[model samples]
Target: MRIYGPNGTTLGAPTGNTRRAGASGFALPDAIATPETRAAATPKAAGNIDALLAMQGIEDPLERRKRSVQRGRGALDVLDDLKIGLLSGNFDASTVNRLRDAAASLKSTSGDPGLDAVLSEIELRVEVELAKAGQF
Candidate 1:
């Protein structure tokens, strides 16, 4: 295969001529690690751990509600799939396994009473289905 250069010109053989530069005004800042800077930049392990613990303690109620809703929806979808599979006599063990997993995820409280109630209902349905499948 032949190579082509810009403007669709066929590439020719390379030449030996070369160019060199003498000087440039650019100068790098001193980046050497000194003891003073090292001490200043070093992170406090205790403070970092405390901050991480604090962050973990903070939970947004809306986010929790959203997560619970998603879990409920996933359980409903699996239930629908299970129903379809049963009706069609094409049931698979993996769908039962997924229903079990969805059941586990539904146990977390969403910090909202109505959402928690709905999720509880979904969880109950999942449990019923799992029981019928002999996997509970």
Candidate 2:
């Protein structure tokens, strides 16, 4: 417990305070920090290629992840192409809406940041390409 004056001046504090028992109930705070530090220092997700290969149930985790990433990138690229076609009056409203929904679904389901970055770079390239082609 701490004692304070009217202006929040520190008067005194009790050294032997057995306050909250719900705080892991450890005698010292450092006792609780060791396990937490170890947990945080290690990766939580199962990403080891060897571990994935040892699984009999999972045929190929790495291959599936790669394919999913590539598929997502392709979907985003197709959407970008459709958007450009719509802006150029080559595609109709329904085509534009379908491509937009496909892009949204890919964004929702994709777990790879690398693929997302690739998609962003591809969009930039498409814009530059369009300018060079005198479309914009």
Candidate 3:
């Protein structure tokens, strides 16, 4: 039997039993007996518990809140500097990158609703400025 190509050219039927070597099947590797493999996987929640325990060592809730506010203020100051530089057309790529880094590094979550709101607004403004400058 013969086969015709799409363009009506005479193409001969497949001629050989063309099963290539190493193409027959796939096999997953046997489980390695390494030390890590032998050890049981730690539960994800175990890490969370450790983090919670570490947080408990903070002791003073008020001090923790104060630190959060201070971090927020520092982030705000960096944003303000970036804004000034942008307005003056004196901003460089490095300054914008630094501002981006600062914005990303901000982990302030002051318990006070008003302060949190202000921090959110400042963060939004920084995002907008970065977007306008095509830095985001």
Specify the highest-lDDT model's number: 1
> RMSD in angstroms, candidate 1?
14.3
Single out the weakest 10-residue window by summed lDDT for candidate 1. 13-22
Scored by lDDT, model 3 comes in at 0.64
Give a tens-digit lDDT track for model 3, residues 11-123.
33322333444766644333353222224445455457878888878657687678767767776777777778868978777766766865675545667788778777767
Which has the higher lDDT value, candidate number 1 or candidate number 2?
Answer: 1
- TM-score order of candidates, top first: 1, 3, 2
RMSD of each: 14.3, 16.7, 20.6
Ranking by lDDT: 1, 3, 2
Which candidate model has the greater TM-score, 2 or 3? 3
User: What TM-score, over all chains together, does every model reach?
Assistant: 0.63, 0.31, 0.49
- Candidate lDDT scores, in order, read 0.79, 0.53, 0.64
For model 2, the superposed segments whose C-alpha errors exceed 4 Å read 1-59, 107-113, 116-136
lDDT of 2: 0.53
* Winner of 1 and 2 under TM-score: 1
Candidate 2 TM-score over all chains jointly: 0.31
TM-score of 3: 0.49
Q: Which lDDT tens digits does candidate 1 get at residues 92-133?
A: 999999998999999899989988899999999999889889
Clashing pairs in 2: none
